[model samples]
Target: MGAVLAKSSSFLFILAAGYLLKRFGVFGKKDYAVLSKVVLNLTLPAAVITNFAAMEWSAQLLLIPVLAFLLNWLMMGVGLLASRRQAAPTRALFVLNCPGYNIGAFALPFVQSFLGPQAVVGACLFDVGNAIMCTGGSYAFTSAWLRAGGQRLSVRDAARRLFSSVPFDTYLAMLVLVVAGVAIPQGAVDFISPIAAANPFVAMLMVGMMFEVDLKPGYLRQMGLVLALRLGSAVLLAVAMYQLLPFSLPIRQVLAVMVFAPASVIAPAFTVKCGGDAGLAGCLNSLTILAGILGMLCTILVLGVA
Candidate 1:
């Protein structure tokens, strides 16, 4: 427990550093934009490939894709229904933020600590499907919502729009490399390991920077409701899956608790790219991170990893 908290604190510290860097203009917005692109496209995909390569898949791992999609869809439904009485922008944030969980970095570290190296393999399998959903699902939802709101639409433009925004294709390419049994040269893995280590740190720093932005308190107020819904839904789903799913109890517990993890740190960037409100999205993203810390702690206390 002490170790988990220490690691989590390290993550938050890196996030704070990113915030300070941005605020001081040490890394200009243009620099952040470029750095983010490199991390998402190049570093992230390499990390995914390396991690997934470490796994030995089974029928269970194959179901992970479907489960990830369903979990996101279900949570999106909860967000949409909850925010129906609110405005489009609010709903957009709600839907866009639903599929988020920094499973690769946040949950994986803790799971590895509690459940051992094997948990790392399970998490990579889970994250592959998650990466696909993040790329495809977020694109489809954001593009469709924007179009319906009288925003301009073009299939080619949308395709290009989606491709340019995130690292899904890169992640997919890495997954293909692993699935096809291609060796990732030793030099490449060593090179990217530092970047992979930096992923969460970079995200946290970006969050701290976002905290410096000025916004109405009313807009920030809704974050409480958002946190409640997100955590509640995850806990409920975890309990249900544990009791009902045919998978091993350990896997069910891991997935359920993971659902309670924070909104993906990358969500604000995605929302901003899609012409959504970046600041509001950032606010929600921060609140979820704070709230998720509690949820994850609770899950760990109760479940005590296999």
Candidate 2:
């Protein structure tokens, strides 16, 4: 328990450090965009490749994507129902904010630290579906919902968006190598290993830099409702998985942690694209990160794993 607490504290401390640095003008908000690109295009992809390369392939692992997709759709339904009475743009933001999880940047570090390589692989595989939702599913849903007449999204366009994600592309490449019994050259692995190691710190720092809170009229109430519905669904799902699933401990643990992952950072951008309030979305995203950290810490303690 002490170890888990220490680990959680260390992660939070780094996050605080980043926030403080930004507050002090050591790094400006503009710098965060550069840093985000670094994490997304470079460090994150390297980390995905490194971890996936090290994993043992299994046919049973196919379940991860299926589970991930189902969970996201379920939450999308919750979000849509929760905001059905809102105006179109606000409704789009509410629904957009609910489904995607910040698995790669937020959940990966904890899973890697507390679980093992197998769990890392499980988390990464689950992220395959998540990346799809983050990049394309949310946008498509919002567009259809907000259109005067509901419209279907182009499947090809969505696929193009999904395939263009660097981390997702890396996942595909690594999976191919794993299935073909190909090994990454030790020299190349050595090159990537250090960059991969930077993922957790860079990711946490990005979250801290992006953190903000807003207390405008009715904003708190809306944020509270969205969070309540999201977290409530997570609790029910966690209970069901624990009591009913036939999976092993590690798989259950990975899913449990993932259930509480923060809203995707791309959410605010998507909200803006849908003509919603980006500031409110950003605030909600930040708060979810804060809440997710606490929720995951509790989850770890309850599971009695460090």
Candidate 3:
């Protein structure tokens, strides 16, 4: 427990450090955009390559990513339904902010520390499906829904955006490698090792740089509703995965805990792009991280994960 808290505190401290640095004029307001590019286009993809190379093929574990993909679509649909009467921007705001999971920089570390190695693999597989939606899937869908990009939600547009994302492309390529039973070269893994190791620090720092908490009228209501709906679905998903799925204990535990992961790290950026409130999105994102931590703790206890 002490170890877990210690690691989590370090991550939070880095996040806080970024915020403080920005306020103190050490980092310009737009500096996060630079770090964002580095994290998204470089470090994140490096991490993906490393993790994919490290895995041995397991056909049964493919179910994990499918669960994650379906979960994102489900939440997005729920968000749309929740704000059916609102304008396109409002509906887009709800849709953008509601789904996706921050499993890589947040949940994966905890899983690695507590849940044993197989669970780590489960978490990695889970992130495959998650990266799809987080990187571009949700954004493309929302953009098409709003006609924001002058492209309808055609298969071509979606595929084009998905391919353009470095992280998503990396994930796809790695998926192919895994399915083909092809191994990534050891030298390549070694080259990526140092870069991949920097992903969490860089990703968290970017989040910190972008973090804002300007409360406005209706902020609480919107944030509260989003968090309530997200966590509520998390509980239901956890129960279903734990009880209904035909899996071993470790995989089941991973599924239960993964469901409680926070909002995607990039959700705020997407929300802003979709005409949503940046400050409120950041607030909601941060709140979900807290809620995710608590919910995951309860899940661990209830499931008696070893």
Candidate 4:
């Protein structure tokens, strides 16, 4: 119990420290980009490599990403249904904001902190499909939803979006190696272990620096609806996975917390691209971050994993 508390607390402290440091001008508003580069290009990919390399391959492991991919589409459908009577822009907002988890930056570290490296395999695999959706899969779907079918991506474009992410690319590589029954050399894993170990700290701090909270009157309605749908879906996902799935306790717990992850960090940008209001998207995205914190804590406590 003490060890779990300490681990969670330390990660939370680093997160708060990043926000404070940015507020105090220790890091410029945009300096989170540097941290972003390090995380996506370095520490995160290293962690992905280490975790996936360590994961014993199974046909069942492939289902994790499939579930993640399907979940995004499910939310997209829900978003459309909820806003069916509204304007196109509003519908676009609902669809874009409703799905997409901030796994790499927000949820991964939580799984790592409480569950450890082997458990991270589930999260990493989940991210594979998640990265696809968050990066451009949702965008394509939203564009189609808005009758901007002309803007729909080619297969090449979709491939480009997925391949463009360093950590995501590493996920594919590792999955390939594992599926092929090729063992990653012990020396290679050892070499990247130190870099992988930095992931939780770097990722938590990066999220803090990137965190924004700017709520306004007009945002209230949209933000509330988006959050309600998001959290509501999270409950269904958690219950379904926790009670029905055959996963071990740690992986199940990780998935429960993960389903509550905040809106994707890029959701606002995608919102604008879809002709939705960036302000509303940004506000909802920000609030979800706070909600994500609360949701994870509650899930951990309720499951008696703490």
lDDT of 2 at 137: 87
For model 3, the stretches where C-alpha displacement exceeds 4 angstroms are 84-88, 104-121, 131-152, 248-250, 265-279, 293-306
Per-residue accuracy of model 1 over 112-208 as CA lDDT, tens digit each: 4455433455555566557554654664676576432434445565456446644455545655665677777878777777765555555445445
Candidate 2: worst-modelled 10 consecutive residues by lDDT: 145-154
lDDT of 3 by residue, 25-144 (tens): 999989998987887777777877777776656788888889889889999999999988787766777798788988766676556546665676677778878877887789889987
Per-residue lDDT tens digits for candidate 2, residues 23-111, read 99999976778778888898888877777767777777777888888888888888888888778877877788889999888898778
**Candidate with better TM-score, 3 vs 4:** 4
The TM-score values for the models, in the order shown, are 0.74, 0.92, 0.81, 0.94
Highest lDDT model number: 4
Name the lDDT value of residue 159 in candidate 4.
84
**Model 4: lDDT of residue 15:** 80
Q: Pick the candidate with the highest TM-score.
A: 4
Q: Which segments of candidate 4 are over 4 A away from where they belong? A: 148-151
User: Whole-model lDDT for model 1 versus the true structure?
Assistant: 0.64
Instruction: Give the lDDT of residue 258 in candidate 3.
Output: 93
> Against the hidden true structure, what lDDT does model 2 obtain?
0.81
**How many residue pairs in model 4 have overlapping backbones?**
0
lDDT of 4 by residue, 1-306 (tens): 666667778877898999999999999999999999999999988888888776666687788898899999999999999998887778878888899999887788787667756568888888898888988888887887686323666568988978998988888888888888988888999999999889889998998888777778888888898899999989999999999988777678788888998989888887777777777777778789888987877787788775
In candidate 4, position 161 carries an lDDT of 78
